[model samples]
Target: MINGPNFVKGFRVTKVKEFSLTKPKPRTIPVPQKIPTQKPHQPVPESTYRSPKEQEVLQGKKLTNRQKAEELLIEANMEQFKCANPEKSEKTKRVLSEIMREEDNKMAFNKVKVQHAPMKVDNVPVRLNAAAILRERALYQRQVEEELSRIEKLVDGARDPSEFLEWQRQMHARDLEKQLADIECRRLEGKLSREEALLARQNLIQENKKKALIKKEETEKLMRVYAEKRLQEEKEMRDLVEQVSEGHKNTKQARMKLQKYKQQIVQEVAEESRELLRQALEEAQEELRKKFELIREIRAMESVPFIRQTLVDLTQTAGHGLNCEMSIVELRERLALLKEAERKAEEEKRDQILEEKQLKQQHLLDTLEQISLHRAAQAKAAVLRLEEKKSKSQLGKAAIANNDRVTELQRKLEEKMTERKRQAEALKLNAQRSTSKSCKNSYEEKHWKELEESRERQAQLLQYGVVSGETANRMAAYQAARNGTSQAYVMPS
Candidate 1:
């Protein structure tokens, strides 16, 4: 790089060279001035008395600057004039000089004045001046004069002025006389004031007192009539009460009689029901017994050889002849007979079985006795042999034979004992079986009897219209008596 002093020296010299100026030569020439040309004026058309349409356009049209300035000056002048005298802006005074000039405008303005004159004057001050007062007073004087003249004419019957003038003087005197009469009447009225008012008040008070007396008399008469009417009503009420009490007593007695009749009817109904129930129960029992007898008869006939056909032929022949209205007691007796027959039949069967068993037992006993006797004989034989053996001890062969025979006899006795034990066991078993069967039969019979009693009682209760509880209790008692059993009874609450 160059030294700082040298760099500065070169930069300064170049600056002066770049900015160096040369001397100038002068030459003279005049500068021209430009003047703006003014636009030519176009005159506005003169304002003519236009129709309403033309006038509206002229009034609403925009104005040139000059016309605007002129209008502003005119408005300023008018405003200054209004400020100088505010009263002048009020109802404009009529100027005779202006009216006399401009004939058409004056005539138009007068016509407007004639139209608005009353309204304008109405707004003016109404000062009561001498002229107005005089005019009013003159009008009053004229009206009075006309009245006076008419009155004179009427008094005189005048059709002419001469007669009227003569009547005018006379009427003046008559008016004076009338005025004096009115004054006299007013004086008389003033003098009578207190006496007249007192008389009027007395009349009014008398009329009021008479009205009050009449009203009181009428009220007292009405009260007397009302009291008499009330007394009559009380007498009627007392008579009615006595009649009602007598009727009530009769009704009460009748009701009691009716209640007694109802009780009698109820008792009759209960008795009838009980009779009907007994009859129905009897009838049902008879029917059941008859049916059972018929069944037994059929069974018995069937059991007999060829007897069913015989019975059928007999029934066909006798059915129409038989009595249908058999009583329950008769049927029950018949059923009992049948039951006895059946029991006899069962007893006969039992007896037959017992006879058979006894015969068998007797036969077995005979056999056992024979066997015991045989065993005894064998023992006797053995005993005899022993005796013989003892007696003949030297005969040895015979003694040995007797000993063997005693052993054989002992075996035969043991076999017979076993046979007797077996027979006893068989008899015991047969007896036990017979006893159990008899017990079962007895229990079934008892149960059937209880059921039959219950059914009979139910029928009785149904016919009587009594409750089942009472019927059931009676049935239980009846069953207990019949079956030789005890019964518990429960009462209803």
Candidate 2:
């Protein structure tokens, strides 16, 4: 019993409360109400009528420390030890220590305590024994159930095992037929030639044959596996039945009867399955025949001229020799020979036509060459005549409109040369005067201003003395030749 710090205070210490069991008071009974007459009786839900204690638990009210201790004590007593003092017994002490350790672990490690109501026995489902039920059932009902179970097992995960394979085969066949039809359509549309169409058909037939063989093998393997599993299951069933029969040693007649009924059922199912397989095969064959007939009609209606001609030749050449007595291989070989001969003949004819076309083309090319030469000669003569007339006209115009500006040009050149000479003399006098009067500060702004002013005056005089356009152009060309730069030609306005 540990004392808290409050016990040392001057004020009266709060006494530790001791745990005590209190007697419960009698609960008051409620008065019953009379039933209603007109309205329909609605049943109240069980949850609404739950006891207060159950309601408190459902509301997630946690137990206090004393209450938890009381629960532990009660659980300890419920172990039912034979010792006079259960609290002092070794097993009791061990159980209490284990419970304390678990509680301590829960408190120390488990942060979350999920509060939930215990599941009731009424909520648990009752397990049934299938064998017991089967044993109790009548023979006729049992047989029916067995047959149904066997049928369900045969179906497994498919719609019906008997029909699934047939359906898959039919679907595969339809897909193949559709692909063949598309190929034929492409051939008719000229997307594929006759040889390509034939090759595609042959490859498709080979693929179909291979797929059929694989499917047959797969089906055979599946049947073998199924038979093996069935045998194993039957053996297991027989062993189980023998074991059960040995326990009773009196149901031999019933067992024999059941076995005979099962055999009959199996034989009947097998016959029905075979009949269904035969019917599906016949239906599929019939459908294929109808589809082939339709295909033949469409092909005949849409046959190309070349194909029709080839067929006609084949019929005319080999029709008499072909008989029902001939084997397919012999017939095929004969047709192949006829086709080969026809191909050779067609090739020769094509070659002859190509030779004739070459001859005609050569003749036309020679004729065109001669005509082009004659036209070219006439064009050359006409061009020469036109050129002579143009030269003559150009000479007459030059003589009529000749303007002799050489004298005027010479006069302008002399004036420009005199003006340039005066400017040169003035620049020379300025340079000599600047040199004579040059001080240490001669490169200063004042001296620069004077030099710039003289240059501006010289430029003004040169602009005023400008010559005619022809003379200016000639002077610019001459200056550019002398200066080795075109910059002199780009003169200021």
Candidate 3:
């Protein structure tokens, strides 16, 4: 059986033979036997060609949807072409069909299957010449006029006019719908603009919040740094104080001495001891200077950037919104200087007033002293004159003289005595007049003073919120009435 299968397989293999004709001949392509010569140009018959538009449609790359519509119109024109010039339409139809087939093949590649469905041709918009287009338009308008005339005749004769009226109503509804659509469009546009504005505002608010948060963090950091620096300055001041008080820090004796000095400061005030008070004040001032010196040294050690940062911090924290013309510190210093100048001016004015008062007082004291001295000189002169008179009277009786000479001398002496008595009386009268005038003036001055005091008392009462004028008059009237009644009753009839 195996030999039988081998025999059959060998017979099949023997029968199978490769054909020589299936192999391609390895020979070069032969050149033309005769030299090709250019043929003479011959004019093509005009009957073989189509119109320019039909040629363009045939030569176009492919028919897009818009091209397809144009193609359909052009195809429909083929029939019009037959009716107008019947001789050429068959050849044009052949050209148009070939162009359409190529376009359909191209579209089939995009659509997954070839659709050989014939597109219904629309009427060709005959636009080759303006004159022809006008003729066609006039014909179409005439047809429309005839149709409208026929409708009007029917509407006039028929009882029912619902169809025409219904068309008019539909047109009005369309116009109304167009207006409503325009209004809705405007409303939507307004809404869109408002929404955009709201979104922009929200974005701005978020940005502001972010900026505020960052500013808050920066301020907190600056405050922390400032607090640390201030604490360091306070610590430095404390150290300086410790150094200044070191001398008094040693023993019981030194502490006692310092304590005693401080105690003496209080007693110094009671004793009016300016020297002790001044010494204590000078020591306090020295300590204060030491503190300020430490502060200055610390400040001087800081960099310019640190100082500028502190200045910026002060400006922002104080909400000064300072400009670059000057610093906040400069403004404060200027204000302080102005205040100090005003205070100095006020003090100078006060001092000037005090000096004037002191000068007046001194002048009054000098005048009083001069008056007393003048009075003392006058009294002394009077006493000396009296003593001289007494001495002369005692000596006159002891001296011897001739009777006539004595009488003449005595008469001259008596005349002199009369002159002295007359002079003394005149002085007495002058003194009395002066005293009386002074007394009269004193009385007038006292009366004026009392009047002024009464006026001042009334002013004070008014100033202290007392009811005046009408109330006072009423009270006075009531008192007057009571007093008059009492006096009348008490009087004897």
Candidate 4:
């Protein structure tokens, strides 16, 4: 007479109670109590004793499973008071039986029957009513039929109860196929468009690559031509520099030679002037000695007296070959002649020295003029060398500018190639993304169909009961899985 909801709740409560009753108790190991020892002064009997193994165990030694079993058996026998005397054991068993029988009787006496409150119809008289019973059964049957039809409609998700779920499954499958076909078509179209674009891009890249190659070749050719020209110009400049260096060396040698020549000329002139002066000095000294000798002879002649004349005659008479000294006026005449000769010689020497000095001055003036001409030539060569160096520097600057332009062109070309490669990779990535999206869409459609089927199956299980609905579905799925069949998801009710 209980309602369905209440019955289910009571059934769950009963299951919980049964589960709790059937649960296993935790296992425990029973240790024996330590035996008391007697005093050392007292004598102990062997009959009231402990075994060695029991003593060891009491002292806290570990035992194996079999040893423990053996100990338990011994403990059980001792607790029962089993002894070697059969009569004593029989008497103990009889006493225990009597005590158990008395306890049973006491427990039976203690138990009392519990009384519950009576129901409303419990005191009414029973009457047989066939028609009423049949009508109640019919009502129950009608309700059962209605519930079955409602469950069928819910499971099928259709207006007509008679329609099989297979039709709906077929319709779902057709819709899935249509979606797959559409997706496949879109994927194929996208693939074709991507391929065509890739092909076009490849062609464009090829054309650009060809153009770049041609440009690079032209640049290389121009660089080669410029390098050869620069090399030729450098060779010309080296040759010009060598020639100028040789000319400078020659000019320096010429200047040094001229300077040596000028030094030699000056040295010869000075030596000749010194020799002429020395000769004139010696001539003057010889003239002075001749004048001194003449004056002395004149003084000796004047010093002779008249009285000394007699003595000179007497000496001449004695056979001496001495002649008479000349007179003073003759001596004076001779001295005057000597002085005149000396003066004439001096005048000749002076004329010669003056002519030599004029020759030396002319030689020095010529040397100075030659040195000035050489200096002018050297200054002109230096001006020409400076002009050539300026021209060479200008050429070097032009070559450097050309090299910079070529390097810039190469850098730009490399950047363009890298940009094209990046764009191609982006295109490939986009194509991959489209294909992945199509695949994901197909997988989602298949997953959605499976979800719908699982929901239908769960709707069918609703008729079993609401409380056990999920559990029954889970059990069915587990059984199906065990049997190697396809398992469906159980939708939550």
**lDDT agreement with native, every candidate:** 0.64, 0.64, 0.65, 0.67
Sort by TM-score, best first. Answer: 3, 2, 1, 4
- Model 4, 363-442: lDDT tens digits are 65655555456557668999998997687556544544455444554455456556656777876686699799989999
TM, every model: 0.16, 0.17, 0.17, 0.15
Off by over 4 Å in 4: 1-167, 225-493
Best by lDDT: 4
Please give, for residues 1-493, the per-residue lDDT of candidate 2 as tens digits. 4665555547786899866657576798988999867988789988777776875764443344446668879997785442122237577889999999999887986577777654333245534344433333344355568879978877786355568887986676556555544443343333223334434555576588679989999999999999999999999999999898788877778899999999999999999999999999999999999999999999998775553343333323444564555555677898999999999999999999999989966765555555456557669999998997687556544543342343343344456446545655665686677677765366465645654464455455557875554555555566546545452333344
> Which has the higher TM-score value, candidate number 1 or candidate number 4?
1
**Lowest lDDT block of 10, candidate 3:** 484-493
The C-alpha RMSD in Å for every predicted model, in order, reads 88.9, 66.7, 69.3, 75.3
Clashes found in each candidate (C-alpha, N, C closer than 3 A): 0, 0, 0, 0
Off by over 4 Å in 3: 1-255, 258-401, 471-493
Better of 3 and 4 by lDDT: 4
How displaced is residue 12 in candidate 3, in Å?
Answer: 99
Please identify model 1 stretches exceeding 4 Å from their true place.
1-406, 464-493
Residue 325's lDDT within candidate 1 is 45
Q: lDDT of model 3 at residue 76?
A: 80
